[model samples]
Target chain A: MKIKKRLGLILANTILIIASLSVLLPILWVIRTSIANRLIAYKIPPVWIFTPTLDNFRMIFETYPFQDYFLNSLIISTAASLVALLIGSLAAYSIARFRTGDPALRLSMLSTQMLPPIALVIPIFLIMNVIKLWDSMTGLVLAYLSFNLPYTVWILISFFQGIPVEMEEAAMIDGCSRFQSLIRIVFPVALPGLLSAGVYNFILNWNEFLFALILTGRNTRTLPVAISSLWTQQGVNIGAVSAATVITILPVILLTFVIQKFLVRNLTFGSVK
Target chain B: MAKSSFFSNLPKHDQQTARNLVVPAMLGIWVVVLFPLLYALYVSVHDWILSQGGIGSFNFSNYFTVLKDPLLLNSAKNTVVLTISVVVLEILIGFGLALLLNNKGIRLRNIYLFILLIPMLMPPITVGLIWRLLLHPELGIINYVLSVIGLPQPLWLATPNLAMLTIIIVDVWHETAFIILVLLAGLTSMPEEIYEAAIIDGASSRQKFQFITLPLMAPTILVATIIRMIAALKTYDLVYILTRGGPGISTETISYYIYKVFFVALDVGKSSAMAFLLLLVIILMTFLLMKVMQKTEQNY
Candidate 1:
């Protein structure tokens, strides 16, 4: 029995070690390739060690205008998420506090999140073209609201519901208007929820591809779109593409880890928590 | 009607405040999501082609055409296969890992978990690109390593069958982290006293899992399954970046196919109809899954 137990422990560790390595090896390979020189990046019987250089990064920024694309991703992600959070929190507060749409309203809001983007993008593309907003920053930001608004509202509704009404009521009793109480009392209390929801939405937007792919022009392409375009242009520039991939994903990885603890709660939409 | 009924239950002053608060979000949804869907429905039924100039005629032929299209059929098949394959593999692998991680004897569990989850939120495009580089036939490290071990180095993204498998592998790599995260959370949050009671009852490990863990975890697993299925059904970016639904369309998904119909063929009406059809499949699947979940819960 003791031998059997020891064997089981060994087996478990072996499986975990394999799983962890599989996940880490590819990411580490990409990072290594990203910093390698052109020849070393794609060398057959790949180089085991080499001095890292920033030429690939410089190439992406100087030759490809990745800075603009990065800025575009930042701006669009921030704008869409902030807008969604601002209005979504209000609606969620109402729904939670007053039962503002009750069963139907709340259900409908969530169901909207399930609407496939392909379904929505069709009309959106046509409408944007008709209105001469195609490939514009405003058009993509507005389009993102289709998912972000509903998501923020749904997630925030749960958060708002978790807060007690007595806090807001006390503020109201202390000569605070409904709005003031919300601003002073409820907002501070729900700050974590708001931040998590906002960050989650921003990440979604930042990594969004299809809508941005179809909607943006040269001047407004987000990082994902920009990175994809790098792949299709001319011959395969493995070094440059590696650098671009690193650039596109590095911030997202950092942000994801920053919010790692809240991820389960956020991803499950507060269901498990 | 539901709104009015809900509003009537609130005090008069509160009703005004609620309406004011909810309207902006409602309007945002309407403008961005609801309005576009309604418009797509309208467009789907009309003979509208962008290059052909405006909504020409009202007809149901677009739906008929989209339904009859062989490519759409092929894409639907691919999507079903991809969705089922990825969800099943991810769940099985994720559940296994989560159980191992949840084991009381495991050390360095948190460190292993953090490493495992690094790909959870990386952009799918980058995931695709990274794999694409790693899988490059001549230059990639994968082939190099394979050659070192005296194994065959297959063209991962070039052959039709291999291309589909490659995409599936990449997706499993990218998305299994989410399943692990969810299931692990469920496993850890389970009541510990129940297990203690099971131990007192002289339950073997297998029996304990089958009798206690499986039944209790049904709901959380179902929730994870539903969310993954929904997302898998709409997969687009990975296919776009990795294969472009190429090697003779072996990996084409419904969304990728619709994208081609709309952008490449410029067939707006037909593509819209296809998109709606995809939406219908998703909604029906979700409904069916929820029904199954309800039945399972009742049994427990």
Candidate 2:
């Protein structure tokens, strides 16, 4: 019995170690490929000993307006998320404090998230064209707001409801207006939830491809669109592609680290908590 | 001055007041979300072509055409398969991992959770690009390692069936963390006294899990499954980067097919019709899920 138990323990640990490696290896390969000189002809046995270079980084910037795409992504994602945060917080506060909408309205708003972007793309495309906002960052930002707003409202409403009403009541008794009480009392308490929602919204907008693909043309292309365009031209520059991928993902990965705890806390919020 | 004061003190509710309070946000959603949905529905039922001036006529021809298209039918099949495979695999693996992490004696539980979450945190495109390189038949680390072990190296993204399988593998890797996180939270939050009682009564581990843990964790598992299903249904970026719906359209999910028809093929009417169908399917599924969840809750 002792030997059998020991064998089982060894097996579990070995399986875990293998799983960890599988998860880590792909990321490591991307980093390696970004530095390698000739990934295309870089042998079947795998060239681990190749000298690294900055040529990929150089080529990506020189060939395409990679920096411009990066800036576009930054502006659109940040601005859209900020708008979503502002609107969603106000709406969520109203719902939480006043119970303004019926349960059906609340559910419907949440269900807007279930409405696939593909369904709306054609109409959105036509609408953008009519407004002469097609192929522009402004248009893309507005498009994203529709989806992100509902998500924010749903997540934030649940979060705001979790805070005790007595805290806000106390603020009101201290001569704070309802608005002041919300800003001063509820907002600070809900900061982690707000941050989590904001980060997720930003990531969603930043990584958005379909709307970005349809709505934006040459000048306003975001990173994902730009990466897709890389294939359109020629040469299949693996190094430059990897470098671009790394650059595009850096901010999102950093934000994920910052909000990891909040994400875990809130993932099971509505059902379990 | 008294007259002015009386005017100001008049009842606050008015048409102007009501519109002022609701108009801004209401207009924002109406113009962006509601208008587009209405317009798409209208367009889907018509023979619309933006290039040919505007909407041509109100007809069900586009819907009939799309429904009868073999390509669309194939795409739908591929999508359902992808969604089912990924959700099932993620649940099994995620539940196992969650159970393992929930054990009282496990060390570095937080570290394990965080590491597993890295895949989900990264953008889908980045995940796709990473896997694309890692699955390269010749120079990829995966095939290289396989060959080192004296095993045959499979062309993952190059071949059609293997491409679908590879995409599923990548998705499961990325999504399993979400299920694990949610289930672990559910497990940790479950009432402990009941479990203690079962243990005191000489219940075996398997029996305890089957009777107590499974029932207690059901709601959270349902929640996780619903979210995963919705996400998997709309998957696009990873497949686009990995295969571009290539190798004879084997990995062509509905979203990818919509992109091709709308943007690539520029068949506006057909794409709109297809998109509308997808919307109908999603709504019906969501309604069914909510109903089932409500019933389960009542039962509990």
Candidate 3:
């Protein structure tokens, strides 16, 4: 029995190690190739050891205007998510505490959250073109709200529902107005939830490709668009593409770890929670 | 539960306050989502090709034209195949990993999880780009390794069927993390007392899982499946980045096909009609999946 249990344990760890390597090796290969010079990057047998260079990163920024794209991504993601959290939190609080919209409105929010970006992006693209908001930050941010707003409200409704209402009611009973109680009591207590929703929305906006691809032009292109354009450019630059891929994904990986605890809850729209 | 308390149950003054609070979000959703969808509905009926001219006369035939288009039909088939394949593979692999990690005797579980979950948050564009380089015919390390081992080095994205399989493989690599995370959460949250009771009764591991874990996990599995299915049904980025629906349109998903219509063909009206059709398919699939899952849950 003891030997059999030990074999099972070894087998589980072996399987886990293989799975982890499957994920890690690709990323490590990317990172390895990212710093390799053009010659070594494309070597058939592969150069397992080499002095890494920052030239690829430097090349992407200089040749590709990645710095501008990075800044655009940051500004758009931040603005869209902050707006979503502000508006979404109020509505979520109302719905959670008072069941404000009850089934109909809440159901719409859930359904809208499930609406494919393709369904929304095509019309938004046409409208943005018509309104001359195409290639503009404001237009992209608004387009992002189509998903981010519904998602934020849905995730946060559950968060707000979890917060006890007694504290807000106590403050109301003392002298605070409902608005004051909301700001002072509920918001403060729901700070972690608010932060989680904000970060989650921010990540979604940052990584959003389809909307950003169609709506934004040269001036407003985000990182994903910029990186995709690298592949389409004439002679595929392997090192530069790897470097660019690393740059685009690095912050997201970091931000993901920051909000790791809340990810399952947020991604499932708090249904798991 | 406090959730049962309706807005009508609140005082009149409080009810007014709640309504006021919800207005901004309602307004935001209206302008951003509802209006565009309504406009999309309006546009789908018109003949609008931007490069040619402005919106033309009301033409409901856009839907019929798209339905008749071989490319649209081809893409619909591809989308269904891709969605089912990816969702099933991700769930199985992810569930297997989750169960392994859930074992109490397993060591280095957290480290394994951290590595596995990294791909969950990666931009689909970057994920596609990374795999594109790795799967490149001549210079990619994968081909090199396969050759060194004296195995057949297949053309990953060059051939028709190979391109579709490559996309599916890449998606599983990128998205299985979500399933692992969700199902792992579900597994860890299961009551220890019930498992202890089963163990005391000399229940084997297989029997414990069959009777207890699988039945209890049915709801969570359903939720994860539905969410992944919806996203997979609308897949576009990987197709765009990896193959651009090519090797002669073999891997063209519906979303990618619609995108080509809108941007490449400059046919706005047709694309909008196609988009609505895709949405209809998604909603119907989601509804049907839910019904099936509920039935399975009851049976379990």
Cα RMSD of all models vs. native, in order, equals 2.3, 5.1, 2.4
Q: What DockQ, on C-alphas, does every prediction get? A: 0.64, 0.43, 0.64
Per-residue lDDT over A19-44 for candidate 2, one digit per residue giving the tens place of the 0 to 100 score: 66667767777777777776542566
- Candidate that beats the other on DockQ, 2 or 3, i.e. the better one: 3
Docking class of 3: medium
User: If both were scored by DockQ, which would come out higher, candidate 1 or candidate 2?
Assistant: 1
Ranking by lDDT: 3, 1, 2
Off by over 4 Å in 2: A1-8, A39-43, A50-52, A231-234, A265-269, B1-23, B50-53, B289-300
Error of 3 at B233 (Å): 0.1
Give candidate 2's fnat, 2 decimals.
0.45
Off by over 4 Å in 1: B1-7, B288-300
lDDT tens digits by residue: candidate 2, B1-300 = 453243244345432332343345556678789999888888788886656666788889998999899999889889999999999999998998788778654556666666676776677877887777677776567788888899999989889898899999999888887888778877998899999999999898799999999998887788778877887888888788889987899999999999898877777788888998898888876676566546655211
Give the CA lDDT, 0 to 100, for residue A198 in model 3.
92
For model 2, state the Cα shift of residue A123 in Å: 1.2
Residue-level lDDT of model 1, residues B1-300, one tens digit each, is 565576687689998998899999999988998888999999899887778876879999999888889999999999999999999999999999999999888888999999999999989999999998899899889999999999999999989998988999999999999999999998998999999999999999999999999998888888888888999999999999999999998999999999999999888989999999999987886665546544654211
Q: Please, what are the lDDT tens digits per residue for candidate 3 over residues B6-72?
A: 6667799989988998999999999999999999999999999989999999979998998799989
